[model samples]
Target: MTRGNRILLSCIYWAFVLYVFVPLLLMILMGFKDSKFIGFPIKSWTLDWYLGVFSDAEVVSTLTYSVVIAVLSTLISVVVGTWIAVLLEGRKFLGRAAIFGLTILPALVPGIISAIAFRIYARLLGIEPGMGAIIWAHAVHNVPFVALVVMARLSTLPKSQIEAARDLGADPIIAFLRITLPYLIPAVLGASIFCLLLSFDDFVRSFFLGGYEPTLPVLIFAKLRSGMSPEINAIATVALVLTAAIGIWAERFTRRTNKDAKP
Candidate 1:
């Protein structure tokens, strides 16, 4: 690219980044403001909102529930998705395309529609709308993502490795555990983190599935309806920081693993 074109591209990229993050920056700034409402031109700054957010029993309980659900659902999705990917690898069977299409259909479907369907399904199954329902729903939605990532990883793996292991007297399970699983660890972890973040940030599915109970996103939505407050801002800031930290850690770990795998 020419120097002028490169500069134009750089400017456009930075402008997009600013557009995306400016509101978040403003929100974080509002968290530290002493004003009663979320507004610009901060008169003063204090940590009272942060303190209040941490001290509120409702906030604490809701956050704890969200964290638990996101973690558990992500873990379950990763395990089940990995197994599914392994089973489907190198298979040339009838309905393979249909199976893959069905697996990812949930992701392509509108979230609100999925939420409504899940609500009706839960009701028909006599399941109460709560943490249990939310976790299951989130896990179902995340499984396809995990499966796709894992399948891609498996595709790149050398078939000879597993074949050689089998030739050396290893059973199917033993060969998979010893040879295939190791190569998939990084992709699995990356996909797990993606699932966790998706579940954590979800609003509509959690709203329908949680019913009386509320996750952090649901709580934020409720609070927004009432009116913006520094307490909400404080909670959002903490959540943002936690998510960023986890994402950075996941990326670093994946990069290190990839480097170690290099010949």
Candidate 2:
């Protein structure tokens, strides 16, 4: 590459990085501020805000609710998505491509649009909002993403291994268990994590579908109506740190697993 192109690429990359992380860095800084309000020129540093994050009963309850929904939906999404991927991989049937497109379309839809659509449908059908509704919404939203990721990994696997095993008199189920499931493990796990995080962080569907109890995002929105507080900053900072830590761990784990698989 030319030096001019190199410089251009470097500039673009750093710009994108700054676009994503600069605000997050600011939030982290605000979390440690001594003041109760969010602002520039932070005067002093303190951990008092973080210490108070759990003291709020509503926030804690909503956080737990979010965790429950995220976990339940992730499990459902991963199982259903993996099954769909397994069935569709390198297979053709009438309307197969249409089904594939439909599944993927949900992930591409704006969350608020999907949430509103589900809300209208649910009300029409008289399905009251609750944990089940929120979990169903989240699972439906996340399935396509999990399917796409798993399908991509599935495509890279050679077809001959399964065929060879079947040709050697092993049952289809046995061959799949011994060959296919083993190969798909990493992709399945990574997709599960993706689904978990997506469901956990989702706001729109949860906001609309949740009943009696609100999730963390919904709670955050309610609190933000009064403007950003030190407690909010603390929560944001903790979330950022945890997300970054998990991302780094997942990347390292993937790398190590891939490296160990090599001869």
Candidate 3:
């Protein structure tokens, strides 16, 4: 491209980066402010809020609760999504298009709309608003993402591997277990991390389906009602750090696994 075009693109990239990260930087800075209120001209800073997050039994328990929900939902999504992906990938059958569309419909729907639908469906099914409901909703929402990732990996898998396994007198199940599953590990791990972050960060569904106990997001939302404070900022900052760390780790691990899996 032209030099002017390159310069313009570079400027735009930096502008976009600033736009995205400035707010996050400000939030993290506010978390360190010592004042009770949230604003500029912070003359002091303290770790009380950060420390309180760990000391507060409620926050600790809510975090643990969120982690449990994310884990359960990710497991459910991985199994169901991988199975559907295997069934549909490179296979033509009656109603295959319909099935594929239905599988991914949850991901395509807007979050608020999907959450409302799940809430209504739960009530109609006599399912109480609680952990089970949240897990089910999150798993449904996450399955499409898992399926897409797994299918992408599956597309790259060598057909010869499956044929070779069969030629060795391996049954379909044995071939899948010995070859397909191993090949899909990187995709599965990546999808699991993605689903974990999505479930942990979810707010709307948890809000609509949660029982007496709240997830971390729900607890944060509840705190927001009182008003924004440094404490809230600290909570959000901690969560941001955690999710970012997980994402970075997943990226690196997936890349390494892909390299290792290569011939």
The candidate that wins on lDDT is: 3
Clashing pairs in 2: none
Q: What is the C-alpha lDDT of each candidate?
A: 0.91, 0.84, 0.95
Ranked candidates (TM-score, high to low): 3, 1, 2
Measured with C-alpha atoms, the lDDT of residue 227 in candidate 3 is: 96
lDDT of 1 by residue, 141-228 (tens): 9999999999998998989998899999999989888899989988998999999999999999999989687999999999989988
Q: How many residue pairs clash in each candidate?
A: 0, 0, 0
Total clashing pairs in model 1: 0
Report the backbone clash tally of model 3.
0
Q: lDDT tens string, model 2, 143-181? A: 998899889878978889888999999898999889988
Model 3 TM: 0.97
lDDT for 188 in candidate 3 is 95
